[model samples]
Target: MEISFTPEIRRAGLAGAGARLLGVAAVLVSLLLLLAAGPPAAADTTQVRALLHQGQDLLRAGQNDAARPLLLQARTLAQKVHFEAGEIEALRVLGKAELVHGSFAEARAFLTQGVALARRTPGQPGLADVLLALGQVANEQDDYPGALRACEEALRLYHDQGKLRDEARTRNGLGIIYSSRGDFPRALAMLLPALHQTQQLRDSALQANCLTNLGGVYFRNNDARKALYYFGQALPLVRRQPDQGALADCLTNLAVAHQQLGEFRQAEPFYQQAIAVSERAGEQAQLGVVLSDYAQLLTDLKRLPAAQTTLERARALLEKSGDVGTLAATLVALGHLHQQLGHGAEAETQAHRALALATPIKDWSVQESAGGLLASLRKRRGDYKEALRYTELAQAAHDTLFTQSKAEEMGRLQGDYQLSQERERAQALARTGERQQQRLQAQQRQLWGLGLGLAAAALAGLALWRLNRLLGRKNQQIERQRAELTELNATKDRLFSIIGHDLRGPLHSLHAFVELLAGPPLPPDKLAHYTQRLTHTLDHTLALLENLLHWAALQMGAAGPPRPENLDLAALANENIGLLTAAAEAAQVSLAHSLTGEEQAWADPAAVRLVLRNLLANAIKFTPAGGTVQVSARRTGAVWQLAVADTGRGLPAPTPLQELRPETLPRRAGEGGQARSTGLGLQLSRDAAARNGGQLLVASAGPGQGTTFTLKVPVAETVEVPV
Candidate 1:
């Protein structure tokens, strides 16, 4: 009911009544000919035996309703004939049928009566069978002590009577009892012997049953590998035995083992097979559990959609079957699936519902699972305190289960560690001993050759020193040449980058305007707009070319001196603002400038204009529409501070310095959402400012707060050139 392979259900019904129908029918059919042969004195006896056998088979096959009447009829006939064996077998079969049908009171009455009769009539071969049947009934009722007692008595009786088959069957049942009680060592001891006995008996059904139980024992013992091995061995045998219930259980076990081993791919086929078999048999209880587990496996594999479908199907099946236990588990699985799919609210709802159902039923396993899922859901939702509470509860439940044996598990781990270390230490010691012997041999060889090699070694040392000295000088020369060449190559690459990417953008814009003007007769405003765009593109293209020229000269170490003049910084700010007006308008940004006429600076006119142009262009590109960009200049004591500022997306954090190098160019989006970077523009501006005995400084109020670029140059004392 809990699903998954661990902490298995008490009565899984894997070997359901339906799975035994074919065997029952075969036995009954063969016995039919014996009845037809003659109506002798033993007619009632034979008939009662056949009827009892058929009734037991029908009950085992899950046909409890049909088996009940047949078993009662056999009991009546046995009583009439005074046949104790037949009567006891009939009563035992009837009790088993009642057990399957959930008639605990009637089952207990019949089985108790049968047990009483078997004891009174000791030495009956069927006594062991009745006791085994009663043990199963007791086990189902959670009467562990009574069940164990019955099983042990039956096993001893079977062994004393030399009934190998019944003894093996009793061992298998006892192993399951031991597993349920958490005594896995005793379970294994019983199951392995049972497995060997079943193999010798050559009964495929019983063999498969024994193997399956062995797998269950190993699984309960936390030995998934051995469990997988036994389940794998049981699958073919069960498949041939016409027991779909067993087959499904085997397949589910195989899937769980593979899943535990993290072989998801191998696990998938077995889950599919088990689901198919359970569905075909209409075993909704088992089917629902299998589907829930399959969904979990799918979730682990990240097949979310499929897992959702499977879990929903399981939910529906559990709903109809009224299997609250499995339904709680199904909800937990669904919650985990929803969490993985990022549906936090739905996951929380499912987890709460799972906990609600599991709590009332006192199912700690389901409670633990739901608690864990709730913890994760709360954690994802940022509810740390609530998550911690659930986490503690889940851990408490988990600890409750494993705490008793924690020491045993820890001891086993410690033993494995010590064994591994011992092996490693032994290997290391062996290696060290071998190395010491080899070192001793090498040392002796060195002593013997000491005098003979001394002169040769001295001569070799002097020659090597001269060779190293020559190599060192050559390496240094090559390194110097390499450094120069690397610098030249980098400079060439920057040049190509600017020309190919930056220059091409302005050229394409001009070409587009030309094509548009040539193709259509436009309104005066439209024509003017196109003409203005063409003029702006040409100005941009010219600026790019001038920056390229400056970069080329810088790379050649032949940059010409700046042609500085005493110019009104106010006039220069206005001229550049007018030039960028069309671009600002196109980007839906407001461009304005304010400057004092008294503010005059000695700087290369072209260089100051380029700096202002690049800064303004970057501002317009990054600023959203309706934003304002303002350029202003003022006399700051001995120098004129010309500034360009914008209410646009500012430079990135740790604003890069306005260095006279290509690498300092800011990498950010501009007006058209293209990179705001233009390597030559900023570099050329910085260089030009430096040549005029000034520095270019950049300041920003972080990204989105806007930026300001200021060119600080010395004020002109004596007019050096005509303005």
Candidate 2:
């Protein structure tokens, strides 16, 4: 009924007392072997054997209270006589009784004691039994890693002794552990082989155990029909055995499988049968587990009231039984039932109860379900923060469980690989036996075959070495190209970033432009010198931004054709000269403009302003202290010419600085020292001038002589004013 593997269920099935009638059989074997060896009568070991038999009988009958004192007495008497076998058996049976009652800690203590004694006695075959019991105890407590270690060791022992049936039984136990961890593939791999072994051994009880656990794997994997088939097969076989606990488990699993398949009508009878078995055994804890699962089926039927009632009964039974894991699970089931009843607040309270219990025990399945339900409840009430918090908690629990399952699967893969190799070796020996007479002739051919194989291997190695060397050289070339591309991309990004950096001075004062256009302009010499200088700086900066922005848009094809107009070159030159005044003063350079009223050009206003600003900014930035920057404009033939000349480090052979690149670092100047690159601004201005049906020209005598940039635009056409 508890989907997780329980020691109570595992011990009641394939292993422990279920493997054989250890009571009379073990006592008879001990007596016969001792009699044949002619020893042990001096210590009254026969009386100790009698006590162990009596205790084991009561234990197998599920009478724990009656068996405990007898098992204790047997242990005491056997220890006094130093009858180690009888003492160890008594300890194992005592642990079995405790385990049957769900007292895992006490059971583990007893089983550990038994294992230590069995190990001290050399060649003790009973060690495997103790280890299997301890493994079950560890699993019930959710110590999966510890359980794996114990079960695997016991498996190795069983296989070494050629005890095929016991090995199969251990495999069944391991299958259930994997299934409980929600690892279905490995669980099936482990179960199928054990199921086949049980068939060969004709063990009805073990076959039932394997079928039930295999069905559990299928159920958890959502293959309900296959689960139902295996569970149905197990039920009748379990019924043939005297163990009511095993029968109850089989019945509960059958019901769960049927419920999973949506066969509620078929599931009800099995749940009732399991409940009846539990009541007969007087196990309130086991009864609680069945009732909890039964409520799930009821909830599916939309019988909410009935489900609530069932869960209430289960909660009371589980609380008294002190089964933490099942009790926590029952609380979550009750919470869901409460939700279906429309009692939202009550449902939350039940979920919290389950969470409190599950957290301390690290019962991740219970914690996850409880947390998920609480998250939904909070979300319904619009408490999104709390909902998110609980959702994270549930996910963490799920990931932890998943990680543990994956790690176990990896370990199982390695073990399976070794197991396959061992099987292959066995087959090879059998084949060698069948071909014994041909050994001499086979040896002669094998020698020649070995020579040919070595020659082939040497040739292949030589080819592989040459191929590796070629690949290495190719990889080096690829790395070099990749590095070059990376550098180019970085340089392009830096260039764009520089443009944006230059735009910020104007963009920051952009609000001033909006306010000035909406209000009044400053009168000449009215504001303070610093404020006056800032005003002049903002004026030309606005001009620079307009043209720069428009030029960029046109180059990207984001805007239509440029708007040509009769722009006044004299006015534009005076405005740029005013804008560069503050920058020229900061650079210790004098600036002036010479423009006549007759100068005018038919070109895009924004494009012309951008070319003028780029040339003027370059002049101010590069000009040395006490140097002069002059802006002049005139009409040359049918076009207007605007030129900015600066007394500073002149231009290189125009090609080098005109190109845009980050590594176009500053060249050493004559008197100004190393000057920063004029950079992509000039290139941008040149391209914009071409797009506007004009050109930008540059001239310099040499580095010490200074450079001059001239802009040419078409002369405007005029119509005669004849009235």
Q: All models: lDDT?
A: 0.74, 0.74
Clashes of each: 8, 0
TM-score of each: 0.46, 0.44
lDDT score of residue 658 within candidate 2: 34
On TM-score, the leading prediction is 1
lDDT of each residue in 1-723, candidate 1, tens digit only: 001112232332326554565556645664674557456648788878777767666654556665676778889888887888888888877876677677777888898899898888757637777788778777777666667767888889889999898788788888887777667887889988988998898988878887888888788778899989989998899889776777888899999999998999999999999999998998898898899889989988888999999999999999999999889888988888888888989989999999999888877787889888987777666554476568756755655445435544443444344445556656866875676566555545665466746754565567557656865786687679768866875666566556655676556555545544555365788677656656655755776787788768766868667788777777877887888888788889998877756676777787777677777776776788889998887776788777778888776664653533446546654554343356567777777677667888887778788877888888987644435
lDDT accuracy of residue 592 in candidate 1: 82
- Candidate 2 lowest-lDDT run of ten: 656-665
List runs of model 1 lying over 4 Å from the truth. 1-82, 122-125, 275-287, 303-306, 375-723
